[model samples]
Target: MSGEREPVSREESSTVAAVQEEAEAVALVPELLISDLLRYGVLLSLSLVTLGTLVTFLRHPDYLVSSEALQRLTAPHPVPHGLRDVVVGAMAARGQSFVMAGLLVMMAVPVMRVGLSLLIFRQQRDTVYVAITTAVLALLGLSFLLGAAE
Candidate 1:
């Protein structure tokens, strides 16, 4: 306790700091490259599925109903029972169509994240930053998809 310690060299100090920073990043799952890859892939897949649904809607255009129109159609009416079924079906389809559209948009979020990751890596070659960015993109995309489904 009485003896003075020698000063750390600049190189040694910087290396130790770098190592500590890396260790902290390693402690977070989202700070790993594999995590980012998983997110990017999942988002891309969800978007594709959504796009497919949109295409199906396009092919079956006769059933599509805007929200305003659906509300109007669902209003109580003194119509034949069969006609009521038609209105109800249309209302359901309207919601499904919107959900599919939202999924498509959500998918784009992951793709955008991938691009940002690449840019970050190019600028600094830091895997932790890439992983974090990708993870964020994935979570946002998933949230969008889930919200849209509802």
Candidate 2:
């Protein structure tokens, strides 16, 4: 057998291109998933916030008529501080609680995205990104801890 390269064939090249396209499509799936995650997360957060505001206005119509009611609501209170409180309050149809939960959900979206990216990178065997994403996750956790301490 002659030690020479074979001539490129249209069929072979097209097969190679098809394989590359398939790989690209596979890569896009994760990106699309992440995109959808962010989109839906934000949308859900917005919806919750809107619903909460509507409920608040409906329940406390005085807020619409009086600045005092708005001021009172804006005043800091420690009732719905914990996760359990937020969940219970939200379940009980409390507007403020729903707003709190919505804000929490809004804050959580990016963190969730990062966590998802880490998983994707890990699955893809991308060590660099995995490490970076891990570091970012750790930093986010640290921020939450520090903020809680404040």
Candidate 3:
């Protein structure tokens, strides 16, 4: 037989192109998800903080107190222990609660990004990455548990 190749069929070429496109899209999912998570998290948190600040200024025009008084009022406090308390406090227009919620959301974004990574690694059957992601998740959980214990 001659060494020359036969002309490729259009259907076969189209199929190969489609498969390549799918592979490229699949490879981009994790990156896209991470970027979107970071973008949305920051945006949402900023919105919440801004809204809280506006509400505080509007509701309490005399909120501008002495530095010492402001420091005392904004002193570090433990997070609400229960969801109900947080939700109720936020609904009641508690500026601190809104700010706390925003901070919490900001913190959660990275954890969620890690979780998405773990899932993607698992789906791709990447054992090394899966193990690494799992360890990271474990450490994150441990930190939260230890912090809560304090």
Candidate 4:
């Protein structure tokens, strides 16, 4: 065979380019999803916190209690109890509960992103990444469980 190579047709070259572009787009889906999760999660959390603050100030213009009194009241129990209690209190228009819920939502965003990554890795049949992601998820779950037990 001669050392010279045959020129590829325009149609063939376009088809190859299209295939590459499609592959690149498919690969970007997970990244895009993660970005959206972070963006929307922060926005939602900020909205909740802002709404809660507005409602609190509107409902109690003079403040719920004196700053010193509030500090004394909360100093004994700095950390909140559980999600159920927070949700119930928030439903009752408790400003602190609303803030707590927003914080929880913010914390959950990264966990959700990790979960999505695990799913994407599994779908792509990437065994190494799937295992690593699973381990990370397991550690996260364990940390939550341990914290709750305390």
- Measured by lDDT, the strongest candidate is 2
Candidate 3 on 26-140: residue-level lDDT in tens? 8888899889988998999888878777777777666775466576567896668655776788999887678767777888889999998899899999999999999999999
In angstroms, how far off is 123's CA in candidate 4?
Answer: 1.2
lDDT per residue, candidate 1, 1-150, as tens digits?
A: 223333446568989999999888866533466466657766665765565567657766654855675566589865322334534533566444444444544555556657656565656778887787667767776875686578
| CA RMSD per model (angstroms) | 15.2, 5.8, 4.8, 5.5
* Model 2: per-residue Cα lDDT over 46-65, one tens digit each: 99999998998899888878
* Residue 104 of model 3, lDDT score: 76
At residue 22, what lDDT does model 3 achieve? 100
Better model by TM-score, 3 or 4? 4
lDDT-sorted candidate list, best first: 2, 4, 3, 1
Q: In terms of TM-score, how similar is model 4 to the real structure? A: 0.79
The CA-based lDDT of model 1 is what? 0.60
Residue-wise lDDT of candidate 4 within 29-148, one digit each (tens)?
A: 988988998999999999888887787777766666568756765677656668888899799998878878888898888899899999999999999999999999999999889999
Each model's C-alpha lDDT?
0.60, 0.89, 0.82, 0.85
Positional deviation of 3 in candidate 2, in angstroms? 38
Compute the lDDT of residue 1 as modeled in candidate 3: 22
Q: If scored against the real structure, what TM-score would every candidate get?
A: 0.31, 0.78, 0.77, 0.79
For model 3, which pairs clash? Answer: none
- What is residue 132's positional error in candidate 2, in angstroms? 1.3
